[model samples]
Target: MEKPLAYRMRPRNLEEVVGQQHLVGPGKIINRMVAAKMLSSMILYGPPGTGKTSIASAIAGSTKYAFRMLNAATDTKKDLQIVAEEAKMSGTVILLLDEVHRLDKTKQDFLLPHLESGRIIMIGATTENPYITINPAIRSRTQIFEVKPLTEADILTAVDHALADKERGLGDYPVHMEENARLHLSRATNGDLRSALNGLELAVRSTPPEEDGTIHLTLEVIEECIQRKALTHDKDGDAHYDVISAFQKSIRGSDVDGALHYLGRLVEAGDLAIICRRLMVIGYEDIGLANPAAAARTVNAVLAAERLGLPEARIPLADCVVDLCLSPKSNSAYMALDAAIADIRAKGSGDVPDHLRDSHYKGAKDLGRGLEYQYPHNFDNAWVDQQYLPDKFKDAQYYQPKATGKYEVALGQQKNRIEQWRKESRQKPR
Candidate 1:
């Protein structure tokens, strides 16, 4: 059987690689490595279809080295031994190890000797953050580079290249793709060249040619062929965390549109667990004392979402996200608690004040515990000056209230009155 269009259109050399100018462009690391023919074991990591495999193939082609492909997760030690034997005969062989993050100890031990001997130039490809997922031994042995998502223009360039190449692409066919349809094909795949090229082939093969003997590709045709836009969210990959970070930051920054965009992505990925967890955090961490009611409502919204489930769950999530984006923001309460925690961690918490300590036990008065304790409720405004903090931290102030909302403003005013009373009490004669 003939190879698929995507496989057939793999870059023959570094020059044929479309995107990743940062790595493959002139004077860049990979380009310099190729130019010098000084191949080294390396790892390329990023989202799917962003040209990790293409880079490996291009490197092998440019160097004229024998290229071999195997999956770290599936291919056995025997397959690695075969590649090692090829390296022994050919002087050097480039091995493309897919899913290198899943490499087990046995296969790793077999490959390490070849990698160290410079007989096998290993190019590991993964959709994971290699630093986090790959074993430290393997990671230490290779150079790590991140392949970024291709731009729309980059996707269009590759698509055009595929369409114009007769031997490997669709240049043999009398196919006429409209400009909008071409743009849609590039955009719809969301930077996946494999999807775009294969989708193009599917559209061409499935559609009937006009009486004039030309396949006319339209927007609808390409849209139907591609089916759905590829979302760059692998729960086990870096993109998942990146989206969650953006979602929380957008809401905290009060950008309704930006927050909604990220929320929509999470919704599309069906990550209700993360959504609920993050929203509840943002409600307290970002909205806090400024709008406690909004934060409470956010919790209720999350509960509703959990009960309703996705598709329909997105409705309440959207409502909460919008409310959070527009609500008055304050982190004063948590910040105050964090400050006290830092002090306790650094200087250590001193003993509780004797006056504040429990004194209901036998012979407690002899220990002076609660001996001078005064009940604030017996005084005016249900308030009185008393030592509440440990004597060592008597002057420490952790609660710095913000005036972002009416409720916090009232609390701030009350705090000022208490501070004034404490100052007066401290100055008075004992």
Candidate 2:
């Protein structure tokens, strides 16, 4: 039986690997390390079908090290112990642990001692963030190389190579791919080589063989094998980025319908709970003050999604999306902080103004910290005019409230109070 196109075309050497040139190209850090025989334990962090496993295979095959494979989702401590023992006997063992984040804390801890002592050089591949999923001890010891999605050019090149390799590819079959059909497959695959090849193979298989033993991939055949039309956001690939971009922009633009459309795409695609949490951050950072309820609603949506775990949770996500989009827009708070950061970066760190510094510490008063700092509560309205900013930034205004939502009304009242206080302070007898 012939192997599947994805497996048959698996890269055997670094030169054959597709995408992730930053890590695997000639003279790159990872390539240089492998060349010098100085590969350390490391984590390959990226989305699926970005050649993480293929890279590991290339390293194992081309290098002289003893290679061992294990899946963290299934492997136990006993399996690790056996590998460690083998490595101790042998000079070096490269343990490739796929889905390393799936290992529980205990299993992760089991490998730490061996890793520290250099009994095995570990290479872990994960789609999740290592900082949140893996053991800190193990992570601290390993170098993390981020793998990026393949470019359009990279995907096209892979397809061309697959079509040209008569030994292990569709080259023997006289299959002609239309330009539009090829572009559609590339875009739908979303930078995943495996997915692209699989889709192409399926399309070709669905077509009837010609008299010359050749199959032509027409638009009709490709569309028929596609099953479901590819969504704008695929949850696993570049579509995910495109959908999220549309969702955020819709909310920012106050287009409630557009926002809900993107929300539907995301929920249908089955993104993890963490992605919802990240969207909640956008609500807080982008729609704050002008729509104070937006942040709270977004947070509740994330929590609901986590609790219900899809299908049911999508309802709350939909509601939150609409609410955030309809809410008045404001990024004043975000702008204020960004401007403040820019100033800080340009001016460098400055000492806290004397009036704002803590005076409770020993010798703080003697050093003039907190000197002449008026107590706001001591005043009639619990407000006082005091120098809170550094001398250079005394007049800098960072918090400009916008005229929108309930916050705007409350802020207007507060502004009036502040003005009254300033007027009273000036009129008082010296």
Per-model clash counts, in order, read 0, 0
* lDDT value for model 1: 0.89
Top candidate when judged by TM-score against the true structure: 2
> Tens-digit lDDT track for model 1 on 1-430?
8898999999999999989999999999999998988879999999888999999999988999999999999999999999999889878999999999999999999999899999999999999998899999998889999998888789999888888999899898889987767876776566788888899999999989999999999766876898742236232235656788999999999999999999998887566767898999999999999899999999999999999997799999999999999999999999999999998998889999888889999999999999999999999878888878877788899999998988888889999998788788889999
lDDT of 2 by residue, 1-430 (tens): 7778988888877888898889989999878988898878999988788888888877877686788889999988899989988988987788989998887777778888888887788999999888888777778989988888888788888888898899888787778886656655665555778888877788877788878877887655654554323344233446646777887888888888887887777665455443585578778777788777778878888888778887788888777777887888777788889888888888876767888889999999899988888888998779887777777776777777777778866876798789788888879997
Residue 406 CA displacement from its true place in model 2, Å = 2.5
* Candidate 2 ranges beyond 4 A from true positions: 13-29, 61-64, 76-78, 85-90, 102-113, 145-157, 167-169, 178-193, 209-214, 218-228, 231-250, 253-286, 299-314, 336-399, 408-430
Q: Rate residue 252 of model 2 by lDDT.
A: 84
Q: What is the Cα-based TM-score of model 1? A: 0.63
lDDT of each: 0.89, 0.78
